[model samples]
Target: MMSTPVANHEAIEKVRDLIQGIDNAMLTTMTSQGLVSRPMKTQEVEFDGDLWFLTKKDTNKYQEMLKHPAVNVAYVGKSYVSIRGEAELLQDPSKVKEFWNAAYEKLLEVPYDDPSLILIKIKAETAEYWETGNKTKMVKTLFERLTGKESEETDLNKTVDLD
Candidate 1:
């Protein structure tokens, strides 16, 4: 299996790019019964290793977090990123205004001040990422083409590990 560039800053940047470029992510939260997942709209703002979303405090997701704060955020595209983090329900009006978007008003049907409206803050603790045709793959492809040798597609899933 190929070793992921876990210590490489470039690799981290690539992972962040994938996460930020995506508009939707699967937020997996633990419920008293079992794991629950929901499609959530990612806020358009800087990540800084944290992901934020707007929601209602009365929603099942909020209730679930009150019981269990551990969460897994999944974003997949040409690559995949699985982020393990803790989620907290935030009620700060300033933060709400900072991440607020007019689109959310229409999407959630809740005003900024609606008592139910809340900010879900996910503070990532660890992450694992894998990509197809990233730098390493491109280099291999170039070398094989120059040598008139056919290259086999690499399996990245077998190469990834997280703390």
Candidate 2:
């Protein structure tokens, strides 16, 4: 039987927690040649089914997103989360100021008000996560591996819909 979609608040919060601990994510985008992946610093904010990042409008990633908005973002923390989403490029000055930080001065070597600076908003459609267990469970899993027996606790993988 097909499993029911996970659209509850608990599932969304679980995804937010997993991604909150991750500082960087590999954003995969499509290109004419093939798929290109880049490491992007995630904006620090409460996750609510969307993600944000800063980039330049002239960059190849921006062009690729314009061509193909479908993207995948993978985060690795205590758990692993893979998010499939659609990306939109935005240049709203107020939002730029809202998400801006002093660190951008050092990283971008320019003020936040620079016209070239832009934001990428990814509206997540679905997210899947693999959460590892605690030390006791880890030990049990190790024993099971050594004994060539499958473990009973195998419900760590979950997929949540962010629609």
Top TM-score prediction, candidate number: 2
lDDT of 1 at 137: 79
- Candidate 2 wrongly placed segments (more than 4 Å): 1-6, 135-149
Model 1 C-alpha lDDT per residue in residues 1-163, reported as the tens digit of each score: 3335664344445557767778889999988789999999888876665789889876899999998999999887766778888998888888887777788789888777777788899877667776654768756876887798876854444222222
Candidate 2 lDDT over residue span 12-123, tens digit each: 6888988886889999999999999999989888898889999888789999999999999999878879999999999988888888888877887778889999999999
Off by over 4 Å in 1: 1-14, 134-163
**CA lDDT of every candidate:** 0.76, 0.86
Residue pairs with clashing backbones, model 1: none
> Least accurate stretch of 10 residues (summed lDDT) in model 1?
154-163
| Candidate 1 C-alpha error for residue 5, in Å | 16
Q: Residue 91, candidate 2: how far off, in angstroms? A: 0.7
Please state every model's RMSD to the true fold in angstroms. Answer: 6.7, 3.4
RMSD in Å for model 2: 3.4
